[model samples]
Target: MSNASFWKGVLPAITTPFHADGSVDHAFLAKHAVQLVDAGSTAIVPLGSLGEAATLSFDEKVAIVATLVKAVGDRVPVVPGIAALSTEEAVKLAQAVKAAGAGGLMVLPVYVYTSDWHEAAAHARAVLGATDLPCILYNNPVAYRTDILPAQIAQLAGEFANLQAVKESSGEIRRFAAIKELLGDRLVLLVGMDDAIVEGLAMGAEGWIAGLVNAYPVESVQLFELARDGGYAASAELYNWFLPLLRLDTVPKFVQLIKLVQAKVGLGSETVRAPRLVVEGAERADALAIIDHAIATKKA
Candidate 1:
């Protein structure tokens, strides 16, 4: 409701809907964006991890961002992910996202198989420097192995006013608290881990960049609202109910699990790009059962 640059609330890293043939399903993706917005997400992030950013080509990513911007049509802010392996490419993608009418950018650390934090910070600054749009630093150490430490984030935030937010996915609540303590109200703190959203928000996180929100936007937003309203007990109840489904998004086969949950909800197909196989038979059934149980329990 507010036009804050990066306030705390629910922002779904929307799953990239794919056709059965493994091509970007633009039609389904557009519809899925609308579904997420209508279901209650304050923002939508296309081309995120759940969106299978690594599997998509540069042009495909651009097209997806464009489509989401057009589909969302001002319903919610669309912050596209820019996870290129190179700094130049990341900047180029950020420009593309800006041109596509994205509200902001979520940048993951370059996946160049290195542990250079300075290089990572430089790359992030380069990307943000090139774009006038606001940027959210994505700190997913498990995926990038380069944790954007709280001090580094404070430096980045101080250096770039447009470095408006940081999505902490380190699974460390203390790290979230540390960032809050270091930066205070200077930077927007968004929780990337679904299970930690409530705790993070309780500790001054303003929003959530969640993958599970792709399938359960209503429940996710409800949890966020409860937390925002100081209803920790109620928020915990919803969170615990959805914990199993949310945990599925953390597994090695996260893309597979997200798609499976989408398919189970009849929101989209369970298709992912190559090298990332779909969960089938037992795994697929298990994921679906978890999703079904969560939905049923929440409804009850």
Candidate 2:
């Protein structure tokens, strides 16, 4: 795929719906993908940090990608996140998802071990070389300990033909300008953090790999459009209204909290995979209050 054809606009990193038995809920997963696309999302991204990817097996991950590919068909791209405990496994996954009919890849730093630039770049290069699919290098140092800085991202972009975009999630506004200054539009920049959409766009971010979009895709897309198109008064009001809920994406429990929002809105359930559970007591109540407030007084 060409750079213009893929990796732009609102790409919601979707959550994996699970059955009561703790198995992958492929049915709802497929339904949710189409729903997001129908709601104005530019693409469907599966198996990211928000999707509880750490708990899924390799086969399950491939199946999730295939499910999304079949679910969305030609309407949108199914870009599965390439991640694993080992570089070899991550390479295998990149190739497998391509065979499973994924349109693109969201290349991530290897899981768990936070490596230096040498190791991180090598791992990313391995995955990038595994397939010719267009890729978006996901750089969220907050969640994924390995930080691929702007200089390193430029190096990878120069080396790989398929490295077409960078998902900037460092929460640093300066990184957007830093990457743009280095690459000069050679690579498209997408905002990976939900709360940073306006600021990222101000610094030349053309798209969004959003998290809160799992529950509020329309509002998320609206926020991006308002900010991107310079709708000052409307954008400010919407950002103020959406800020509290969008901040949920920056926290550690974002997965459970987003799923809770989906459940509250009748979109999906709160069932997550192992090593993470649904929020409860004070945490659950606090999250519910945020979601309710957004719904009750939503204008922008």
What are the per-residue Cα lDDT tens digits for candidate 2 across 1-300?
A: 578747778999999999999999999999988889988888888989999899999999999998999989589989999989999999999999999999899999888998989899889989999999899999989887888889999999999999999998888899999998999989999999888888888889899998888888788888988998984465998999999999999898999999988888889998988789889899988999999998899864
Candidate 2 clashing pairs, residues 3+ apart or interchain? none
> What TM-score would candidate 1 get against the native?
0.95
Candidate 1, residues 1-300, lDDT tens digits: the string is 222645457888888877777788899889888988888777888888888898889999989988988999587778988888788788889898788788888888886566677788888888889988777889988877888889999999889878888888988889877887888877788888877777888888888888777777777788788887875786777777888988887788988887777777777777788888887798777877888887677763
Cα RMSDs of all predictions? Answer: 1.9, 1.2
- The TM-scores, one per candidate, come to 0.95, 0.97
Residue 130, model 1: Cα distance from true site in angstroms: 0.4
- The window of 10 residues in a row where model 2 has the poorest summed lDDT is 1-10
Which regions in candidate 1 have their CA more than 4 angstroms from the true location?
A: 1-5
